[model samples]
Target: MSDKSKTQDEDLPYYDHPTGGWGSVKSLAKIIARSRPDPGIMQTLWRQNKPGGHMCTSCAWAKPDKPHTFEFCENGAKATAWDLTSHRCTPDFFAEHSVEALKSWSAHDLEMAGRLTHPMRYDADSDHYIETTWEEAFEGIAAELKQLDPKSVVFYTSGRAALETSYLWALFARLYGHNNLPDSSNMCHETTSVGLKKVIGSPVGTCKLEDFNECDMIMFFGQNTGSNSPRFLHTLQAAARRGCHIVTFNPVRERGLIGFANPQSPMQMLTSSRTKISEHYLQVKPGGDIAVLAGLCKRVLELEEEKNGGVLDKAFIEEHTTGFEAFAQSMQQTSWADIEQASGLKRTDLEIIAGMYANAKKTIGIYGMGLTQHVHGFVNLAMYVNLLLMKGHIGRFGAGISPVRGHSNVQGQRTVGISEKPELVPLDKLAEMFDFEPPRDEGRTTVEVVRGVLDGSVKAFLSLGGNFARAIPDQGQADPAWKDLTLNVQIATKLNRSHLLVGRKTWLLPCLVRSEEDMQATGPQAVSMEDSLSNIYGSVGKRKPAGEHVKSEMAIVAGLAKATLKPNPKVKWDDWLGDYSLVRDLIEETYPDDFKDFNARMFEPGGFYRGNPARERQWKTESGKAEFTAPKVLTALGELPGEGQYTMITLRSNDQFNTTVYGYTDRLRGLEGSRYIVLINPKEMADAGLSEGQMVTLESAVDDGVERRVADLKVTAYDLPDGCVATYYPEANPLVPLEYHDQESKTPAYKGVPVRIVA
Candidate 1:
């Protein structure tokens, strides 16, 4: 091999700088050109971050405390511009391209094709989507539902769903006599929801935006804050300035965690001054989070023994915790050798970090998919909670747990009754409020929905804004199962791959983007949203509609409810559609304690924060206390794939959000030109006798009778952890086995999957 090529193989390109620099500005400009050409677009775009205006159509990271003129990050701008793009995908566009022809288009190509302007249905003979009237579309769906058992229909919602729409979406399904309400939550934060409820008494975070100003230390476990939530860099930068010790534990040295240059500040932008983040970083192995935390706990316990419980909060633990004795006993049994090997860290490294944790009285723990998308995701989360619990750090100002959610409304969707298994017990109140009998049985989850489709129990699939087929695990299984469905319908603003993954029949109903104006029977209407911190607020779109045919998400849901539940007159669907305040009134009546005068509170400046009970040290758990869970270590990682195998982590490009691809380049990661590439450790490449530009086929170790292989991926040597390789997901999603998921939460294990590379 040539010397230059060898060096290139040893490293993927590096920026040697912090994230959120000039590169973000360039990205924002390019996305604007694709979305629209109107000069007034800029004026409308600026309103996205204004208080009393629409929330950013991207990540739900900000606290919504004080309103800023320029509140949006670069990614947020990209999302809004992409949504408000002037390009139109009218009936003519669909008629020109066949389903087979459209399949060849890349993700970017599909998005650039423009926004869908009307409702459409797949014609069996033509193999093309044909335009239909809204009445005809709703009637067709009602006819399909009339033939099947109510249990046979699966209703799914994406995180982009608004709070107002979500409440209506759930009521419609229950009024239809079933609760088959599966949502995106089941695949992502179900572990955080289930695990945290056991420990902290609340599924949401224990702290609010104001807490960032108080914490002495911030521990980022597995999440990449820079790329995922660029706006959060401001918070980290400010905290760093205040002498907060920022520690990061991840397999990759994410640039965002390293440092950040705030684009908003004129001085920082002109001077090119960057703020350093992550005072301490631990390169923990994939699936090694629990081990690393356990090692820290062991050292803390050892100190407590030496100082006679001086290291732990005896007063807090005695009054507010349960099962500490069992949890502590388990920590003592974990050997240092096992911790070192599993975590890929030295005992001294663990001790040093533990000492820092012990010294900090007020700390915040934040994590993302790295800890959630695993077989032991629930316990993976519980371990961090365990450490914080021992310190009595939770349920206090500046100290709590934060699971940074992916979607803007993923948490809000669940909050407003879009859950498969409804969070509130005794559905009688909800039933009484809506004047209908609610289903008692728990509904199917996102994972269970797929199983239901495969087994023929689910004959129909209806979604509100998500690329369900591409986002879900096991395309090898899910794609075919979808084809077997009696009907598939999607309510969306843009065309996605899920709309193309057809069942016996498919339909696409165009809807309004949050950036576009929504005018109902009333003059103008606004939708409310809840941010990642559970801050509720009203957001009204200032721009004109992308297309006149496109309706608001709430309007669509109300129309569907009116047509389907014609049998029930108790629901004043027409009135709810005319005045959204009526819908909010019902929410207050149903969840009186949580949503007292919900309609009136929405008009407040910067909206409102629905406070967490756990923040006040209230434990709603079965024990009426913050319960401690014993960590369960993985006994055996599946066998290695012969001689050339490695663990695989499915990743998102810096240019992408979830399954939405804004561009082909992962600018933050220094990759360009292509998406079908894999990053491997230099030592792993040497041992496997592989070099750069070499082609390899990746296959999952655990197959479900169907052959799962992603072929001809270009390999490059990266500085990833030993024996671990990484690739962008949706491309690598084919390699994720269908049944390989967490036992408790059923979230697919996207990280640390055993795989073999075919040379």
Candidate 2:
């Protein structure tokens, strides 16, 4: 390996701050230098984050009404500068380097190489990618797809695409007679959509930024808000200053949950003083979230019995809910002993939390992957809603459940048909508009798609963005399946590992990023993006294109649709690609209730809210009320480490977002210069006869008979729950088994993985 690639903890220095501070500014400078952008690039950044301009392609945390001089965050700068980077991966670059040579580099090193500049086709004979014309690439994919069964074709989307592109993606898939759709959301928060739909009759969240301003209590369970969504720090800091009590539960005591030094405020930076965030931090063990929540629900019921005055919302429960008695009985039968053993927390700890929730008039609950990436992920979500329903936390401001969504527009992708199972209501609307019978079969998810590929049931695969080979679980199985596909195609901005893993015939279509201008027949056009809060607005690129050959994602999608699907007068691909307004008109017809006058609403200052009716106490269930479904079991963590085993949960480093690794330094956790590492409890390390900084291998404890091991990962002692360990995801993804998933949502159990340290 090269000297730069041989990273260890010995040479690099680590820094710690209360979330955002001067450290972020210094880190931002380092990223800009790495991008090697022109001095005039500042002008592009200045105009890129405006209302009518392209939205910041980083985190989906909603921007404030009152914009700052520099509106973007530290990570946002990295994402934009990454696109504006002068480094280009032309055809010559690929020709000079073999596929095997690139495989030796780290994910961060590969991404830092630069943006792709032209369409390319993989040549198996030479083991290198060669330049190809757009027509040749399109025809190659069309011929192969037309020869295969439409059911064998799988379509996947990342959270990065604009609404214009996503709308066309859904339309084209139905026109081509297939519904095997899967997106990034299936990996992240499918539980929130599925679980919330069962409980509240809606898959969307009810709380807004205004809720944090008015809520008496904010319970942050399993969320590292400061690191994942830094823009949320502004609202969190404001609430802390206004005397709102914050409670947090997680395996790690994240610095963001403890305190904050607002980098956005010059005064806060000058003082170098930090403001405390969570008043109480409960360190719950991994896979033990359900027990803690269940214990709290039982305590609330006890408090209601003793107080007898106004503990439970009796009127609201009677008027707007069902199945309460059944839920209450389940909570009662769940003993404190079982709760303590399962949750790894004492009854007193849960009682303290229960009392806090009971006293608060208004409460907002927020959670993340800690709860969603478990085998009982769906039940974990239901338990939270059950607790909230006991106190009537929904259908009002300052009180509701928020699953803390991860990508910039992941929720938006689902809002506009990037789904495997499109709702019947939307299907009827699409059938009426296009004069085509929508596919009635239940679609496939990410896991299902991978299984199809492995069994030879699936023949072709197409991706808009995201590196599926690295992002999904069971790399040992998924990677080879991708290589053996009949055809593989990717429409992407940068070169990822997935692009290098070629099938019989693979094509990489270069597309313009959010920072580059999208010129079309209808002149300069602006696309739309939806935030986690369901706010939709226009985003137009400001700067010149990095490559003359690169096309917009919308154009690429339309072109592929025209090439594959036979001509139909109702489906006008060229018109939609040329004028994006025509696409918005189609979306308006698809969801009239939500996107009414979408073309006219695009002109709104920051876009429309696309409000959720559940927020207004209108639960459109079979009974026209919120129905509670209690889990039969209180906790899903059956047992702790067996002999020399540990329950592992995959995590993201501070310097990265999703699968994109910007650097090896994770400032929040105080590690640097390596992604191949594991964090273990010091006590557990001593018991396992392991020492800090020891190079070791991890073998899965699951007896699937598939030897899944991650070797050469250095061990580091950390302050985590005993018998529990953590490692950065996409690196440890191989250790996760495809069979280990939430039964209800099919989300892989990334947090509940069972493994043993190998000598």
Candidate 3:
């Protein structure tokens, strides 16, 4: 390493030491500085999850049935530690801190205040949030909603909302006569749903955890299962021990892909022995996934043609799919030179990967945000499906396309119809069931919702969960749009940056966390979540109430509906909220063939698996087969900066999830105490004559002039690809222009933002 690069590493908070293990003592200090932990809250949190009552809702991964030994991960602990805080945002507290003053505070400082004690409203004159009665808050919101055109209202659902509440909210929106539903999914995995549906006729993954054990080769693309989905580590370790070939392709050399210490394995944990995960690691350039996937498909076709005179599942392709010839022709036209240059991979590496697929009997392709958060996200996903189809890798155990979701119920939310654009069949069924006309017009997506708010077309914003302002990109634009809203309602458990960005008239309604006991008229309620594998399971909170006034998310949604649309007798929102089973009954009515015995199935230890058409190789397309989409011309890749500017991909630290910053420590990347540094290659730093650890500024290279410039950012030299740098999200989100999104998926190209570094 160059002296400058070595200097940069030495200046990092944790240097090159691992985050956990003996280095934890120093890691803890860094965490304290970054998280700004409150002592009183830590004490209360420590007392939580004691022998009897409940577990922390935020860290539900702790196996409740097992011994209390393994309770949380570092990030999970931080979440609980933050929540158990003693600080309260009382009316007096708000009185002292003006909204303007609070805006200037860091996101960490604003959220450190435990929770909102009572309902509050944005008082423009006082420039603070004043506590108000629940009745007045509800009445004010109801009156404003009643005055606006129902279509002008946008309902936003965050991943944090419970199944019961999400269902009620969706129902309320439909009854209110609008389909303008925008949620967290739009910003994350909207591409997963769109692409999967087009290829397999189902939005969910086909493989289950059980299939993970049966697979011969597991190809993980664009996912860091260790940090994003740690629970899968055990499964991957087991598969590796069983001699399964594990291939991982990602821009970052994730520690999890290198290996993992199974916490459950007594012998391994005692010895600190780690299991090898990936047999092969391919570091594809950011935004180069499409070319890589296309290359894989091209090689697969050649192998089929040479070995078996075109053995590519001709029967399945001819009978079930559309546009295969066009797709195949496009693949053939992609020259190896272009593929190698675009994908940052040589011909030999791709051939080895192709050979692995050819030899393996069963293969599974799993991916996460790296594939979805791009300009051609949908096309990239479709190419994966195409490769799987080429090898006849569908409809079998351990073989399918699995998009690992972040939040537990993210997939379930979509499964239960939390979409802006409802399918024709579901829409028709909903209209028939409610005895009212369902809106035919498609609603605005997340990006569109923000645009609508800016243009004054949207009147009300009702978010079920999530810190919207902090989660979205181009904050310079999104922040102002949020403030322009006439009414902004947030149904949440804790205060966050979104709450601080209060609108003209706002209501902060506190709700129950998922890990807390939710008591309704029918008694204690149990919710269900569908994991990434499409296995539905029951999740019951065993913890006591944080406060008596805290209402379940379902009850809050029902209450809001009762106050706003109770006069309209067409919908029975009250009946459904009374018992969660009733909501399941409604789901049964909507998807009768699939959810026929919803209540009965949910009672089972591991809930029943939803039928996946792809699992059976049953493609429900126009031709009743899995269709192939032709690849677009590789012209856009030329648009990226090649000379002076470099592309900066924004990513989350292992310590953070979405917009929720648990702490400042990134164990794998050797980062600690701060999240403002950018990772760059030593060669690039030297070529630019830049000194390590020197503060620098970044400006967008795109012609849109979105003005996303990060100033005084510390530079850290690391083993990154040339012409590429990386920084943490939300902080780097400003560098991404809303217009610079996937043309097909509308997902912000958060992974490949072209930027210029300044001294």
lDDT of each: 0.82, 0.83, 0.73
Clashing pairs in 3: 54-542, 54-543, 57-515, 320-625, 375-742
1-759: candidate 3 lDDT, tens digit per residue: 111223234443332322233343344345555545445434434434333323333422222222335434444455654544445667788888888888786666676666656777888888888888877877888899888899889998876565556667787898887888777778888888877887778776778667777899999888877566665665677799999999988887776677676554577656756677788888888878887888888888889878975457777676666778889999999899988888888889998998788788889988888888887788778888888877677777878888887765777677777888766238888777878777777888878887787788988899887887777778777777777788899887667888877788888887766555788778888776665676555556645555666677787787788888856565776677777888888887887766768888764433567778778878876667787887784422325776899878887877776777766667766676678888887878989888778899988888874567888788887766667899888888878887777776577778878899988
> How displaced is residue 46 in candidate 2, in Å?
3.4
| Candidate with the greatest lDDT versus the true structure | 2
lDDT of 1: 0.82
Candidate 1 C-alpha lDDT tens digits along 10-95 = 34665555587777888778778666645666776667767667877788886456655677888788888788787889999999
| Number of clashing pairs per prediction, in order | 1, 0, 5
Model 3 alpha-carbon miss at residue 644, Å: 1.2
List the candidates ranked by TM-score, beginning with the highest: 1, 2, 3
For each candidate in turn, give its C-alpha RMSD to the true structure in angstroms. Answer: 2.8, 4.0, 4.1
* lDDT (tens digit, per residue) of candidate 2 on 649-672: 888877898889888778877778
- Minimum summed lDDT over a 10-residue window in model 1 is located at 1-10
User: Which residue pairs show backbone clashes in model 1?
Assistant: 35-85
Q: By lDDT, highest first, what's the ranking?
A: 2, 1, 3
TM agreement with the true structure for every prediction: 0.97, 0.96, 0.91
